[model samples]
Target: MESKGILTKLYSFLYIRGFKVWTSYRTQVALTILSWVLPVFTYYFVGTSLGNSLVERIGVKDYTSFFVIGLAFQGYVSSIITTVSGRIRNEQLYGTIEYYVLSRSGVTSFLFYSAIWGFAVNTINAFIIMSVGLGLGIKYDINWLSSIIISVLLILSTLGLSFLSAAFTMVIKQGNPISLFFSTFTTLLGGVVFPVTAMPIPLTYLSYALPLTWALQGLRGSFLDGEGIVQEGGIILVLLVFNVILIPIGVLAYKYAFRKAREKGTLSEY
Candidate 1:
């Protein structure tokens, strides 16, 4: 095959090829879609039970829309940080890590693109969650341009951490403490399911350090209140700063880890 054809096949397999296998199971599809919706109600009822106080305290118009946005976008952050590491783990188990790590596209590009399917699946989940919120009469005043910009900023910021997670996987070939720590802390501190103000003061400071906290705030403002880029300028700047600091460190760590792993001849160890 020509180089162009080869590249096309590689991307085809990376992107939609797994869809056929996944959809082959009818029950899995139904259950997966249900899983996306069930959580919306879970949080909805839970938030409603707490009443308007929580909503007011959080500065959101209502708890339903607030929690809905948080629940929906949290999936993207999780997917970003975990997908590449999960791909590496699977490849290691299959004894195929060496092939991709040593391939012409190299480990960085191969592992990064390998995560496209996971992001696509998260998009479906986000859409379903938003639809459920709408069905429940949760209103939104979306600012499309700001929403897109914030979403992209969120993804890029999280991508840095994901790169670091991949590097940890390459080196350890097993449990990943780096991703684990961030995942745990992000849920508690990043204000994914709750307002950061609910946490103690010190913890709130830590929450401010997380990219997800800023992303969720900016997203909720744009998606629920129609706040535009000018209104979201501070958030955009914070996310940009995070990207600037994290991406370079992550890239360096990942490249270093990959080089060391290859030198140690343990790229496929698992």
Candidate 2:
């Protein structure tokens, strides 16, 4: 009962902190929504201009739908990566790193909870983009159940990546090159704007190594092709493997980095 009470208080504190940060910047929130929505519109126009050729080449009926969904998933990926890395920097800058280190919740838990706001914002932006796509007459035959399952797996995989990012932040005490590299690499090669098959042979093979590639493929298979989890079994299996492998590795790396930072007396340093 005592442990439960502490856990509840920790969650409540984190929730309120996230809510306050979100509401404190109403203009930034509005602009962020606009930023996400405007790209869907631009893609709609560009996809239309490409006509049915992209459809024939990609095997999806509507290029706009394909592009939008890929971009939406990428948005979530980017958010998790950036938020996990940035949270440590923010705490350092605010001189609150010591508070977190001293907290009963522990540093890892604190960093994860601090990213709640970013995850929520990204989710809202994804929904807005999807809604705008539907409003623009981009049809989807989404398998909601399968999509949800894949989404959960994607989040777990992203959590692993975020943990790795957190580890980097703990050690480096600076900007997140990992987030930047993965964001750009996945956007370009993970079939965000185009199918990976369209890339050269070497790039095609390289894309398969990325978690986002399997994620986007699974999502597109579910949403665009209306495939169930069973139908997308191969992609699902790969993603599950990624989660199983990456999560433990990420956690160990983060703990090692945290220990190193403390040993170096750099936890509170920016």
Candidate 3:
């Protein structure tokens, strides 16, 4: 009974913390929604420009639907993964690092809770944007279950990569370069503008190793190709395997970095 109570309190705290963070900045939330709206318009124009050309290249019956789905999935992947690594820098600047370390709580659990909040906001954002796309007659067959699965795998990959970034931030006491490097590398290599297969062979090989490549492919394939998520079961399984392999390694690396920071007496420095 005592254990149950503790678990209940933890879950409640998680939800409350997420909500508090989300609601604390009403202006930012509004701006985020507004900013997302602009992209729908941009994509509509671009898809219109592509005209019949996109059909020959993208292989989708409806270029509008494909473009919208791609944009939505990209938003999902970017928002989900970027939050964790980005948190490290923000927390450091705001003097929240020591608070996180000295709270008599594990960092991993707290990170997971914080991600749930980010995920919630982004999911709502995606829905709103996609609804507008639907209004523009951009409709495609999608499997919610497969999307959830892809989301789970993407989150795991994001957590691992974020932990890696957090470790770098903690050790170096800097964030800009590492953050920019990862964001840029993934954005270009992970098919944000177009398909990975369109890249040269050498770059295509590198794309295979990128976690976003598979996650985005899985999401886009489902909606644009009229394929079910389960149809891409092999890739999904590979993502799950990658996550299982990386989590322990990430935790261990973070633990080592944390210990090093404490020993160097630089744990509190931003």
Top candidate, metric TM-score = 2
lDDT for model 2 = 0.82
* TM-score to true structure, per model: 0.92, 0.92, 0.84
lDDT of 2 by residue, 101-211 (tens): 887778888767655656776788788888887887877889998898888888888888888888898888776677887766788988887889988999999988888
- Collision count for each candidate, in order: 0, 0, 0
| CA shift of 18, model 1, Å | 3.7
lDDT of 1 by residue, 1-270 (tens): 588865785666554565666678899999989977998899888877888876677665588887889888887878767777888898899998778756777778776665566667778889999999999988889999999998888877777888899999999877898778765667777887778998899999988998889999999999988999999999999999999999888889999998998899888888
Better of 1 and 2 by lDDT: 1
The segments of candidate 2 whose C-alpha lies over 4 angstroms from its true place after superposition are 2-14
Q: What is every candidate's alpha-carbon RMSD to the true fold?
A: 2.3, 2.0, 2.9
Candidate 1, residue 168: CA error in Å? 0.7
Task: Please give the TM-score that candidate 1 achieves against the real structure.
Answer: 0.92
Candidate 1, which segments miss by more than 4 Å at Cα? 1-14
- Name the Cα RMSD for model 3: 2.9
